[model samples]
Target chain A: EAEVAQSPRYKITEKSQAVAFWCDPISGHATLYWYRQILGQGPELLVQFQDESVVDDSQLPKDRFSAERLKGVDSTLKIQPAELGDSAMYLCATTQGSNNEQFFGPGTRLTVL
Target chain B: AQRVTQPEKLLSVFKGAPVELKCNYSYSGSPELFWYVQYSRQRLQLLLRHISRESIKGFTADLNKGETSFHLKKPFAQEEDSAMYYCALMPGSGGSNYKLTFGKGTLLTVNP
Candidate 1:
């Protein structure tokens, strides 16, 4: 089975520094999602992409966070000037259709000092 | 706004015991419900969805429209069943714009 791939499984950075996470969705899956999961809480959607176009990003903090799927196959999420509260698990998921199962990646754990 | 609530943060049961994880949701329109599980060092994976009504790994969940609940249940829990479970809800037909609203999650520990 093809799984979503994420890099830098763990990251540590200080506040005010920049951090980035990468994700590659399953082949042919057009819809991709980025989520943040704080400790003791469930995942929260940060952004969604349909191909290379952003379908939704209302929850994303535009001032400090940005995500892009330039090639429509993989994506990159960046947070400039990371905050302490940004310490969380960043997850990437993908689905081929609206009703299909969303496959999740192992996630990138970010710890800001 | 749609929201999912899993009241119990932690649940423990002995092997072979019946286990139930409560999940409630608040959505005005018709919603699709799902249960996702993450075992130790494993990525989150779909355990089951209400639309399919299928039992997976001896676990089953029923959608109660009247009560706005979709609780996961299993008659005989095994030690390997210990994992963090999340209940999620997707509004409408789950089109491209729709997103999943997840509950805080429940940590199930099936002990020997």
Candidate 2:
């Protein structure tokens, strides 16, 4: 079975440093999502993308965080000047554009020291 | 606005026991509900969706429109059933821009 792929399974960075995570959604999926899950909490939507175009980024912290899908296939999420509170699990999910359900990838665990 | 609620933070049960994970939602429009589970050392995956109305791994959830709830229930729990369960809500009917709002998850621990 094909599954979503994520890079840098675990990352530890000093406060105010830079960190990046990557995700490749299932083929043929047009809608991709980025979410953050702090310890003891459920995942929260950070951004949503539809074929390289951002659909929703209302919850993404623009000043320090950025994401892009250059070819509308794989995506990258970056956090510059990471803060201590930025420690969390970054999850990437995707849907078939016309479907309500989604498939999730193994998350990248970030630890901002 | 759409919201999902999983009231129980943790539920402990023994093997071969009945298990029920509570989930409720608040949405003005027609909503699509789903249950996602994350087992230890595993990625989060969809356990079931309301639209499918199919029982999976001895688990079932019924969408109650009047009550605004879609709770997951299993008649006989197994040791592997221990995992973190999340209830999600998507209120929009339009396929485009479908965003999922997830609830605080419930951790079910099935003891041996």
Candidate 3:
């Protein structure tokens, strides 16, 4: 079974530091998404990419967050000057098209002091 | 704006008992609703979608436009069914594909 891959399953950093999370979607998937989930809450979309182009980022906090899918397969999400409020589970998901079944990765649990 | 509301944050049911996880949404146009489940130490996976209208793992959800709800229900619950479940909505008309919204989620604890 093909599954999405995420690196650094767990990360802890102090406030004002920078953090990055990586995600490799299932092979041949064209759509990728990044989401943040606080403890006891559902995941919220941060950014979405379709074949290397951003589809939606209206919810993304542009001030400190950035996401990219250069080749349209793998993606990276970065947060600079991370704050305590930024501590959450960073999840990556993928689908073949805009309105297809989404597959999610194991996620990267980030903790910022 | 699209919003999903899951009133209950936690639900505990005995094994073999009937279980109902409430999910409600607010959208003007036709919407696509889905149920995602996450077991212990596992990634989130789709349990069922309203469009499919097929029951999964003995769970079924009926989309009631008048009520604006798509609640998941199972006639009999099992211990292995304990997990966190989320109700997601993809507004059909004007909402973008990537603008899906999810509720806070409900933690179902099926006691044996």
Highest TM-score scorer? 1
List, residue by residue over A1-113, the lDDT tens digit for candidate 3: 99999988999999999999999999988888999999989999999888899989998999999999888889999999899999999999998774557899999999998
Stretches of candidate 1 exceeding 4 Å from the true structure: none
Candidate 2 residue spans exceeding 4 A from truth: none
lDDT of 1 by residue, B19-95 (tens): 99999999999999999999999999999999898999999999999999999999999999999999999887666
Query: For candidate 1, what is the TM-score?
Result: 0.98
By TM-score, the candidates rank as: 1, 2, 3
**Order of candidates by DockQ, top first?**
2, 1, 3
Chain A TM-score relative to the true structure, per candidate: 0.97, 0.98, 0.97
- Could you arrange the candidates by lDDT from highest to lowest? 1, 2, 3
Residues forming the 10-long window of minimal summed lDDT in candidate 1 chain A? A93-102
How do the residues B46-82 of candidate 2 rate in per-residue lDDT, one tens digit apiece?
Answer: 9999889999999999999999999999999999999
lDDT of 1 at A85: 95
lDDT of 3 at A100: 55
Supply the TM-score for candidate 3. Answer: 0.97
lDDT of 1 at A60: 99
Candidate 2 lDDT by residue in tens digits, A3-112: 99999999999999999999999999999999999998889999999999999999999999999998999999999989999999999999996777789999999999
Q: Write the per-residue lDDT of candidate 1 for residues A62-86, one digit (tens) a residue.
A: 9999999999999999999899999
- State which candidate, 1 or 3, has the greater lDDT: 1
Q: Pairs clashing in candidate 3?
A: none
